[model samples]
Target: MPPTPPSTPARDEARIRDRGDACPGALRLHAADDGGLARLRLPAGRLTAHQVEALAVAAETLGDGRISLTSRGNAELRGLAEECGAELAALLAEAGLLPSPTHERVRNIVASPAAGLDGLGGPEVQLWARELDALLCAEPWAAALSGRFLFVLDDGRADVAGLGGDVTLVAVRPGAGQEPAARQESAAGQDPTAGRLHVGGRAWLVAGADAPRAALAAAGAFLDAARAAGNGAWRVRELPEGSTPDVAGALDRAGIAAEPVPPAESLLVHAPPLAPGPLGTASFHVLAPLGRLTAAQLRALLPAEEVRLTPWRGAVVVGAAPGHQDHARLAALDSHGLITRPDSPWAGVSACTGRPGCAKSRADVRADAAPGSARGLPVHYSGCERRCGHPHGTWVDVVATADGAYLVDGAPTPRTALPDAVTTARTGAIARAATPSTPAETTR
Candidate 1:
């Protein structure tokens, strides 16, 4: 009813690519409307307070005094000087952020931020995140992957399963635990590491596919598919049906057994979105009004050892205790304007940079996208039709069409009707969010 939870559906064929992936990296910068931009990859978005502080200092001293969170769970430093690559590189290198130069861009990985801390999702996926990352960086051939290539390690909670990943591995469990009704028939067995594998258009029931093996096999499968396609396919979803990697064969070749999931019973995989606020009493998840965070906001997270940046423009602040977060420290974050409670409307808002930051933008979306007014669903304000950072699942899409008039998910609406439409959409999404059958639906 509420845009029935998504499945791992076959996507439309992608066009061939002739050039390199222009995605920015810590050393390689992109010239944007504002200035040079550098992206730092954080596998699973795991970062220590020291690492976070290092990034904050670099942003304040070398860039625009701001650090932006990305949908890939990465970090970006913009407004950089033309010749600051050397300084930026040196700083990041010392902080151990750049593990490998050749594979930095290809290190696009996202996992459940609350994997273990939330105590609901299966398998502590951050463990797999590191092992897989190490394997990727060590394999020279992996460097050939396009910067846009992505891998998802969902913790069976569905938080990041539907970010349209090139390769996805999700934990399998039974009973009702945040899964949509559509998923009941296809729910796999209870295996912390073993789960269904989605590589491009095909699905496989993998055996012995732990994080390390699954990650390696997925990468190998893509390489085989890409080579067979020979059309510059950068992602598994890009290859035609003929070129869809024989994931089963790849796993077998890797000594990882995998059987074809019956097409009818393959996992439905509903990826619900994670709400911003304290997450399940184990940790405090907070978000900025917008995706961008100034150095001061980042500093506010300090004295806290580790943090995980989510694709949804927020973070999970874990506690030193066995299964709880430090309330006082979380309160400090709340003081700094982070949305630590679900009731705060800032939890439901996001906007892409417009105006001075993006030349193609027709409107300054960030200027108009204010938060703190509670909404049931997420609202994304886009400068143009591209909708660069909209929610992955159901949401209220506010796209700019003119000075005041706009489109709500493509239908034209008067400026006056915008709020009502958004409210209606949010109401539906809120109902879905509260439904026990829903799953997490964060973006890529």
Candidate 2:
């Protein structure tokens, strides 16, 4: 591995913030350096084609004519006209993207993009995400959750398990010769006990064969702990180290048995991050180059009714009609310059929109970022020390220093030597996995 970056911002520590979560939502817009920015949470990053077209229209008419894909699998509209709030809200509501204004921000849920489509987690997990989302919106007390509070519905893959979800539900396989059930716990002929529910770094078997309910129970437990802490904590990890809620007890209270599924040790496996490329037979997944999608490009994905966004700046084109091969659509997307191959030079490359868009940025990192090979871990180019939007796991860090040189993992190097230096670091003969810090599953 490229000599482990000497300085990677702490990933496991609970973020201590004195200020409330000011994360913008569809109704609430944050005045960004570029313009008014609106973030619309997509429960599990699921979006219908109609919704996509609506967002495209909104971007074209009310904002920058471009939609930015956030690292959280949500959609962001930048350069919004200052007076576009009423019109924007109306548009989003009509699209059914804004169901609960009160709980819009709290609907920060992300699930495996290839779950049901690719059989990685099956259709039940994505369904659980939707069900849990409805549950969250229906509960008045859930409004107390900070906009930053996250729920990860992973399909037993490590892809999102470590993304720092305060509450996560990981899919578990059923016992051999056993089928899985939907809402009941371990019923005969049912799927694996709706997987397992994990909170912070600890995990427990879920009660209720219904994985969705178990997932919701985990959220309620976090809510209980957050309220008990009374520190306005927005995440389970932030509720003082020893205070992770009794998830088992929470299930018991909810009338679901708190079955012990597996220990934290067993659930700590990290799946290698999924790269941009074709997924499954018909699903075509692509990354947004640098997580930015233009209005036209966003609409190009409408060959189907819906697509699934991923936390990794990628999206899976799903909902295609059966037997409808996406060869032409994939080719068209490729023609539009979207990354759709795993071996492409852009596989693990990313950069922040520096220069004009962000006044805090000192350089145009995107323009300066060279085509990257997939030999090393993911590398991100940041304009300044803030290093906004860096990867979560073992990856390379390249931050632009004021002197025109880039700081490659804390060591200052000329921009000219960056490519070789990064390559060597990534292609190092010895590759090792990062062990879980606390058996606590998050690097979020």
Candidate 3:
């Protein structure tokens, strides 16, 4: 393991100002270089087989035949025409993808990718997830939440909780020491009856409520405090003056049961390339080469086994047949360069369409940072300062500037020679220089 770096003083923490996050959604689209971009938030990253099929149809009918998975466990429709927004929204609504137009953007929820896989925490987590979703939709005021605010319902395994959710509902084993389901107790003892429900890595006690109701109340309380802050902050952590919701207090007020506990380590669901599930599977996960699926390829996936879009930048097709042309389906995707191995360079590398696609781009960064340019590390290719679509986990950042590019590993480095610098990066060679001004000067 890399040596744990010394704790660095917070520098950028105070630099951010509170403003409504301009996170795009299906109803509110962003105009990008390619065209219009529509982000469909999939709470818990869970979608029924029907919803997945509808997404595919929406991708084909309304926007470009391509779909991009987001770090937030959401789906994005790219290259959409302006006129198609309303029509696409209606289609999504019909497909049950959009339950509430008013509360659409606030529905950012993510759960364990393998919640039910191998019988981890299937019924309980799924039940809790549904309860939380229903509660969120029922609250009329939840629409005020920024699209970026996130909620995580973990099965005490910490898979999704570790992704930096503002509010979390973790279900521990029933027999574990839990806090008494009541408020007004002193905050001293670890409530043995209430399993921990952590927020921002800090645990809190829920006094009278179960997991589902406690989570819903916790979210509501966070929103209430966020709005009271009156600074346009969307997430609980973003509230100024430490004004975020108090998990324990909120649970107390809501009459839910909870108690504080240390943050649990979350596991990344890193499934390797595997065979497609049984045929006629309802929900399906598909892996796209470079996350770019062609029109024809997508068409073939139609009438698919169901789909659960994953944050790992892959698609999960549930309910497919055990041997449903597994080799052929994966082979076809491989032909398109979408390999599912974690060792593949493309597995972690991401790039924003630079130059021709984006007007703000100063260089064709994507062309320079192609698959050949990848060096067995998570490197992002950005055209300018706004590094769109960067990786979420630990990664090697190769951000381009006008003069050259800036290389950021654990420590920052400057590379004047772009191509050679890439090669040096692959070899773990550290090249340092004063930050360059031009793109070429930044190369190796």
Candidate with best lDDT: 2
Candidate 2 lDDT tens digits, 47-132: 88898889999999999898777667888888887898999999999999999999998999988778866655566667878889
Could you say which candidate leads in TM-score?
2
TM match of model 3 to true structure: 0.76
Q: What's the lDDT of the predicted structure labeled candidate 3?
A: 0.58
Q: Of 1 and 2, which scores higher on lDDT? A: 2
In order of lDDT, best first, we have 2, 1, 3
lDDT, residue 217, model 1: 78
Better of 1 and 2 by TM-score: 2
Report the Cα lDDT for residue 25, model 1.
86
Model 2 vs. true fold: TM: 0.88
lDDT of 3 at 224: 69
Tens digits of per-residue lDDT for model 3, 1-444: 222212212322312435556667889988877888888888766767567667778888888787776766687888889889779988999989888988888888776555554354443565566667788889887777767677776664554555557776665543433333233244323433233466644665443236667776677777766667765555555566666576667777776544455344322232222222322323334555544555555445534444555555565555443455655665555565555444454555556666666777767765666443444445556666556665443444566666655444323334435445554455464432211111111110
Candidate 1 regions exceeding 4 Å error are 1-13, 173-192, 207-209, 280-282, 320-325, 371-373, 402-404, 411-421, 428-444
Every model's TM-score? 0.85, 0.88, 0.76
Model 1 pairs whose backbones collide: 71-444, 271-440, 272-439, 272-440, 272-441, 273-440, 273-441
